[model samples]
Target: MPIQTSANSRLRQSVGSPFLASLVSFLVGVSTLLVATLLIDAHLPDLSLASGQPGWLLTGGFLGVVVLTGNIFLFPRLGSVQTVVLPITGQVLMGLLIDNFGWFDSPESPLSVARIFGALLLILGVLGVIGFLDALVRRTPVVGNSSDAGPQLWLWRIAGIIFGMCSASQTAINGRLGVVLDSAVAAALISFAVGVATLLLIILATRTPWQLKRIDDGPNPWWMWVGGFLGAAFVFGTAFLAPIIGTGLTVMVILLGMMAGSLAIDQFGLLGAYKKRATPIQLLGLALMVAGVAAIRLF
Candidate 1:
């Protein structure tokens, strides 16, 4: 009886171990990412303007794949909602920090009232879209298994928030980096390197199963590269323009571009996920976000 009880205890601990580790990893990953953005900004202040040199943009794309792939593995285990929400929240906070402190390149950038309002509108729009989607999903008969539905539905909502926050942060950080790195490719490479290095350390320390074999399957998917490239371009472009047009204004423009791209990506379900039809509510949300952005720019 004693031996049996001990075995059962071990089994319970083993089951819980991954969950605990994943949570720790997620927090650490986010912290590292925030630090990395600052470091990249400081490390390559002139990366955007490098001329007469071979561009390293492709390398950056490769690194993006590595970073995202790592996320894919880590997210599911770490509660998809948390995986999405916490990062997004972190990004927003970081953006505010960067803007207020002039951490990277925006020394004169101040977090104005208009910018705060814009950010809030943007957050609301995202939440509205997510809520609408959850409603739609619940209405589907095919997805009506209560037991399976409850957790997943909540998870998706959480994921959406996280994704939104992360997107915002990505915009701010990349934009700041863009100021220093002239070529989008170079910025991608440097950021990718940081992401890859961070993940690699995690893998080494935790003995996580990272599959490099996945990269050799075929010519890499264009969409996978798109996120990184677009991200890089946005960052570079934003940085270039942020100084001339305040940080808030720069993000406003980028958000518009992101909305367009994200809509297309979600509508088609291009990455093997179910196609997400954009409803009226989503359009309304987008409009509100855009309007808020525009207002920030004008006021």
Candidate 2:
């Protein structure tokens, strides 16, 4: 979460266009994975293994692009906390459904009372964290000025949740791909490769430029360029972890880390993310999110 947030922040700070930032991030991520693939002499054989496999498995890359570009567009408008939390809430919910139905050939973990309770808690957490409840109680719009940005802000928040659902699906697909190829790293590489190809098509179709706009007054920091590397680590980790831990547990752990990291980023304004100190209600919301995940996966 931190890595993704940091990278999004940098792109928002330095890159003018969300489409361009998505392209750059994927390019860097793919390049890094390519080097690793060559160094390890990994047995990718994605083409040979492509036949007979469910077509949906390869869609991870497409979903990944959706998430990357969506996050880029969402971060500034929603702020760091909402950008991270909203999608994760969606991720958890979608992950539950994925596990229950064995979507994408993932292992089946049917929903139970505990799981439903967890989902409810997660929804409550989202409402609290996004200040929806507070606004409702106060009889005000969540974003203030219902006549103007209020509706737009709600729209972005909804998009963030949908993007998160894409993220959960991506994780499941990539995990299954990793198992098929017998190499998590190779799966990540293939995912990125497809993402790059998809992004190129989008850029061409939209006529988006390769040049990034300079948002910072001074020269860009070196760390900003490395967000993709961190993203690679995350993709590889989730791909590797999901099959072993089950999608529910995998999403739970990732969400826990993301919530904690996003809070720190919001409070400290790390990675050029907007600074907004978490309120007590927001902290309580975080606690609820943790409990919700625990109920889903642990209890």
Candidate 3:
């Protein structure tokens, strides 16, 4: 076989699998992030875990894998908007439930009537964002090949939603860990390290080859390597803010930002995702989400 010179080329060479491409990309990004986090932590004066909390709280790293890997899988089929929206639908709903009952050791911030309405709005907003309404109006087939495409697409979407819920739970878990550890940085570091460890276990269990050297093969988009950093930012942000605002509100705020970022990424075709414009309906969906977020926060 001819030598593969680029990242995409290598991915294509791997049995022509996009999943493998995404997997490799994610692994590279996360590994890069773990190393960077360690280097930065080395300079901090106190790096010990302060709280003698249960170790299971560190599972935030595994949850990061679910969210990031799910994104890579959905990016091709759902594009950017649906990829972000559907999961966020699950996120907001779970968040509401979490706050209502104080799940995962988060503080009890019961869902009020405003929050219930906000949850409904968030659901409708997701459907609108993904154009389910328009697709229904036009009677356009939502997916393809009826037999295979429809089922497969639904499966992926469901998986994405489940991943979204796991991510929400992970944020709450990490936040609690932060309470125990007394440092957001420590919480984030633990999550990233755990995530790296989990990925390594997965690779070993599946007997996949370690492709560390491939990152140096040639030029690629700089953003492809920022997965770990993005993950760290999220874990740290959630850890730092979850206690102050409660997991539900924190997730809503994050969801708002996610919506804005997803819209921009799709609109501009950023990061190699397909370019798709935000239609008037989708814009309405975005407005609804903003309103819902506001309702959840202000009321």
Candidate 4:
């Protein structure tokens, strides 16, 4: 009886550890990203009065490298869901603030009703995808059960919302910053640096020893990294493109791309995670997300 009890305890602990790790990773990732943004913002030159600022471009490039490295380390711990969800949520919320308050740029920028509705629809679609994925996991015993439940799932859902907001906020940041830095490569570099610095700081504070043993030990799927690079490009590109394309349009298109990319990534089980094949419901949800984007673009 004692042995059975010990085994059960260990089982529960093992199940719980990854979830805890995911949460920690999510927090660290977001915090680091924000810090990187701050770093970029601080180093930005005033290009309003002057035409071009070459130095700011250099700084932005450096930052982009930092952000990319940070993701390389952080994503594994957070898992794909939390890693993607948190930032999406952040983008949605921050995007609204930046658009309405114009905190990062001219205060004259105003929020529109269409954009708000579009954001809502986007959130609903994302939730639908999450629910669909959760259901798939539950139905497939082969994949095993997800540790997420009750409040924990909600927390992750909220994290997704934050991630959305982060995406939007980044659009604003990039738009404003572009005026000074004026180059996508520069902005990407700066964002990367911020990402790296934040992760390094958190690792140091947590006193977590860096482990490289799992690096090459996991799946050798090179395609997964391609998705990551695409994601990185989308993120950095959106920031650079937002100024020309407008935040609403940029986000809508990027979200469309992300939904499609995520489906492909999740379907293949590319990241050494569960393999829950996408179902009709998920496809429907993806369509809805695309529709939401279209609505925003047209209206």
Number of the top candidate by TM-score? 2
Displacement of residue 130 (Cα, Å) in model 2 is: 3.9
Candidate 2, residue 53: lDDT = 88
Ranking by TM-score: 2, 3, 4, 1
lDDT per residue (tens digit) for residues 1-299 in model 2: 57675775677557766666767777888888888877775544466776798888788999988987797788767765577667877888888888989887788899899988987787677566666666677887554222337688889889989998999999999999988888788889889888889988988999875665555467777777787787888888999988887787688778767667867888898876789998787688778878887887777
Candidate 3 regions off by >4 Å?
1-52, 68-86, 143-161, 212-218
TM-score of each: 0.53, 0.83, 0.76, 0.58
lDDT of each: 0.48, 0.79, 0.68, 0.51
Q: Give the TM-score of candidate 4.
A: 0.58
CA displacement after TM-score superposition, residue 59 of candidate 1 (Å): 18
Per-model tally of clashing residue pairs: 14, 0, 0, 43
Q: Where does candidate 4 stray beyond 4 Å? A: 1-90, 106-110, 132-167, 214-232, 268-275
Query: Which window of ten consecutive residues has the lowest lDDT sum in model 4?
Result: 1-10
- Candidate 3 lDDT over 127-240, as tens digits, reads 666676667768976543223366788887788788888878888998988787676767777777766677666666767653433335665455444444455566678988
Most accurate candidate by lDDT: 2
True-vs-predicted CA distance for residue 256, candidate 4, Å: 2.4
**Candidate 1 vs 3: which has more lDDT:** 3
User: lDDT of candidate 3 vs native?
Assistant: 0.68
